[model samples]
Target: MIGFLWETFKIKCLGGLREEVAREVRRHLRTNSAIRNVPQPFGYRMLKRFYGKGGLLSFLLRYAGLYAIIMLGCAAIVSLFPNWVPKSGLNSDRLPDVQNVTSYFLAAQAVMIGLLFPVALGVISLITQREDASSTVSDLQVYYSESFAFGVGASGIALSIVLAIHVFWPAGYVLEYLGFSDAGTYFEVVLLIAHLLWLLVNFAALWYFLVTSLSFMRPAQRALMRRRYAALTAIPDYLTVHLLNHRYIVRLAAEIAKKVGWDKAKTALLFGGRLERGEVELNNKALSGQVLSNVWQKPLMWVIRRWLKRCNKVEGAVGSQPDLDFCPDFRRPLSDDGIICRRIGGIPLDKIERFVVGQSFRFKAKKP
Candidate 1:
């Protein structure tokens, strides 16, 4: 009885899931004018483009909330510090002493550096994740190695220029007129400026590295093909179902779906959507699939990809000639008319391949 009940529950769950998926697919088909015209994911963009829409206002609010929580915790820890480190009785920096002024300046600089370290680390980590797929301890080493090299090089160049102005030209002479009489004071100002410049250089380097690195993630030849295919393919039925299940995103998706046509809007939605789950099929039979899997995984991924490639080639030569031209690019025709074309250029390639090769062909025509 218990087993029967469990089985019944499982059946109901799957049925409900399928029904939900179908409803979303049908809804997009009906309401999204551009759906049929555009590719997947972008058509789904109806769901997840809020960050683009809201811009700085939403970003500020998001970061502000994070800052508030961090500051609150910082306040608690700061409160505890006074109890741990008691006030000194010594008059090292006595009242009204010049030494006190210097000490205060040092304390302020120390505090600033303390605050800046974590901020720098966080920025570096976030930028690295956006730009680099390397996630191991070695990733950190590489990040720091590059970062240090860049920082030192930048600082050296900047210091050299500033030194030329101060030493070779006698810009240091002009500083005397500006009431920075002491050479030490002038040097300190230059040092501070150099520090600020170095910080800016670090940020610039990070941004540059991030953009360039992520761009290389895709193979040069495949990027355009993948994009074209993606546009043609459109989002799968499942993603639309997943997005509409989220209340806020559903409203956003509906609005975008109105203008971009259902397909483009859906494509956009999926691009922006926060994916809760994902799965990848590793099929070396598809060269592109094998390449992608190898790029994403370990030696095992490479081995599986190579094996699949060999099998695909063998299977392809054995298949009937009719099946050879299956999955021909019929996007232009498919877009121009709602009709799904099976034959390529009036040739019954699929049937010919099957009949001649006398083997099971896995490739199907790119149509329903």
Candidate 2:
């Protein structure tokens, strides 16, 4: 019965999750546009990596596994030196400190969910209304951000259960039920330390959430976001059939994706990389749009791009094809619509590669 219930619950979280992520991506695009705000996880970006990756157990394993270690380390120290906590003044009935802290802790946890739930829903509703897959980069950001926010809310609920127990039930009784010969000094130290740690983590999450929320208002962030939004919305039109399947551009994209933060597998999945064969396939064009995101969108040398495209069609009739004639430029397309990324990545690594690096790697690396 327990197993059956667990399976049902897991499905609710995992089922159609990718589609939901897609919907969120669309929603966040609209929300950001209406407010001219940049949509990103910012402080919560770490959670973005696992957005649509798994179910509840995975979240607990990742999130709990991360936070639990701190509490466990504290517990281990208390266990190792049980005598460190003097039993003389210890109260066996309850830890009075817990009563004082539980209310605030529960409130903080509540705030985490409060902030996350609405953001997730807003993203969902906004995207649902517009339903545009054009702004793939912004959409992807919104999707992952929504998934991360909602996932945190799920875990916060579980933590709130513990917080609530402390509020309504005696901590000593709860500890006794948790297991032990008695509610002793060692447990007290571990419990108090754990409480403090949870408090700190909750506040930290709140800080990040608040910072992200306020980013919508900051003039600088909004201007930057406006520019990026212009870039993102233009990406899809450039992603027409030929560009979607371009091998070299795809490779350059995959390389940049690797340098940014995507694992080899994800990069392969996105750009369909095969370095040995020197071949590339664009598996997920939308994701590829994300790969090429944040570049300065502009039309650069459209006359040259069109002439090049036409010239390339008959290049075999020529004596030899120069790199300039064979290779394409992104500035024209992404800027004015010759292509979505007509060499916007800066001149160093073709066009999109440098943009991917600065956008994904440096931007995220600098994020606090």
Which residues of candidate 1, in runs, are more than 4 Å off? Answer: 1-54, 85-238, 241-368
The superposed Cα distance between candidate 2 and the true structure at residue 169, in angstroms, equals 6.7
Q: Point out where model 2 deviates above 4 Å.
A: 1-82, 88-94, 127-133, 136-143, 166-183, 210-368
For candidate 2, give the lDDT of residue 257.
Answer: 38
lDDT of 2 at 5: 58
Per-residue lDDT tens digits for candidate 1, residues 1-368, read 44346434533542222334445566666565555554434422421222112333443444345434433443343355435322322222222243343344444434434443464466456646765455434444333332232333333343334333323323223434543323323233334454344344434444434443344334562243244333323354235535534422344334434432333311233211222222211112232211000010122123223332333466442232211111112111112211111211112223333332222111222422
Winning candidate number (lDDT): 2
Candidate 2 lDDT by residue in tens digits, 311-337: 346635123322221112222111121
**Where does the lowest 10-residue lDDT sum fall in candidate 1?**
288-297
The lowest-lDDT stretch of 10 consecutive residues in candidate 2 is 359-368
